[model samples]
Target: MGSNPTLSVFLNHMFQENSYEKIIQTAILTAYPRIFTDIPLSKEIFDELERIRKTESHGEITAELKVSKLAPELEARYKLVDQLLHKNNATQILEIAAGLSPRGVEWTKNPAIEYVEVELSEMARDKNKIFKALIETPPNLQLKEGNALNLKDLQKSITHFKKDRPIAVVNEGLLRYLNFDEKAIVAENVRALLKIFGGVWITPDITLQKLLQVQNKTTMPGKNQEIIQRTGRNIEKNSFKNEEEAEKFFNNLGFTVERHSLLEVIDKLTSSKKLNISQKEVKKMLEPAVVFVMKLEDSRA
Candidate 1:
């Protein structure tokens, strides 16, 4: 396989239970039904996932365990995203930092919707190949190769987008790893994109919550783990201390922002799934991986 360092960096961020939930979530919400199709994971992807279940290829131990929760995990995300799309009547899905996900293919089933998937140059090519080979994602579902930090690169891709309808952008599982300067620029670029193409979409985590697993502690490789593990690039999250700081900063950028905890969002999703688990367990899980889905008060904001 080709080397994709930025994709690699984001993937490591989700290499734990708290982190991996976002992976399960984005995959389910964006790709699940649209890409895999036929429910319960079509034969091929299911088999691949089954193989992954028995192998060490997925990630660390916690990641594997998190993968085991796929059904409920996916269910939780799908439940929320569908509601969001329905409530907002969005016409397109724009997923950034959307590293290696099946959602692009999954959501293509909706004739009215289109997906604009953006990623690092290396991953965009590989993912485009995997996604294109799996199924025809429609002229609507398009993939672009570029750097997330580079607006010109992102806009080159966006320029091709048929922006005649409402759009939803999922900055899921992003933000925490960016340095303050990079974060400011990216958030601004995204805001500019939203303003340029008006509509409501959600980017849940803004406080840039640090990954923490309670009770049982598993050491997940942090951002620079790749480099520390080998002679790799040292990319890490230069973060703000709390949600207030993130909001205060993001608000100044001109978008009307709202912040919610992972607990609040998960409870909403879990209730939709009707999963049986004590508040204690929920609390435990949310402590490490809290989720929040925000609606842009004004896409133009």
Candidate 2:
């Protein structure tokens, strides 16, 4: 998406390497009720993924393998992002690295809000195909290809927004893959955008190292290990050392951080009932996850 050949090549390489993560996430969403049926082509995508996995893996891992509390955690994260978006009264929303998430489809149904879902080139193309095939594409929903590490790539999506209104920037599962330097670059890019169209950056992806270690060990040991091998990124290495360090990291980057516990949206998750996850289990699963709603420290908007 950039003129610089080296940068473009690097971005493409990153996308290609992590492409399977989207499929796994889509499969998780599709397996659960109230998620796949609500999103138009999610089930189809999951089925296709299953076909590919079966053919490629030779029955090593099937789509039916449950990844412990992953389904519920994802559900809670998705709902919590929406909750924080509404709470901040953000009508113009930009979701970075938005991979096959049905949030855009569902939110765009209300014409009052303008939603832009940005992803790397390949995933964006796939999402475009799904949208066009499933429904009459909503004018409010704009899908673009961009990289979070590059400000110019991110700025390209601004054309779809109303200039007079504040914009809320949201991302779910992006930051965990980045090391500290990459994260700072992303923070700077987002900070620059916030200065232009002032609004909150809502994300639940700011994970702590300890929390990630716990999840990896207990939640879905084998599955998480497989994902780690597939993606080739040490998630724990990319995570903050602790909650205080996470807050300090963002705060030092010119954003005032507000933490919203995932537990706040626990009761709203339908996956708990569908997956038969007890309240105790759900609470334990979600206890460490927090959605950070951040705004530029100096902004008066």
lDDT tens digits, residue span 1-301, model 1: 1112253444454353343232232332233222322233344443344344357354322332322222333333444554565666766778877655555566777777777888766556645555544565588778887656666776777665666665677765455545455556666667667767776546644433343222123222241343222322122334445556666666665556543445444544433233354556545444444333444445433
**TM-score winner among the candidates?**
2
Question: What's the TM-score of every candidate structure?
Answer: 0.64, 0.83
Per-candidate Cα lDDT values, in order, are: 0.51, 0.73
Provide the clash count, candidate 2.
Answer: 0
For 199-220, candidate 2 gives per-residue lDDT tens digits of 8899998887666765776656
RMSD of 1: 8.4
**Model 1 weakest lDDT span, ten residues long:** 226-235
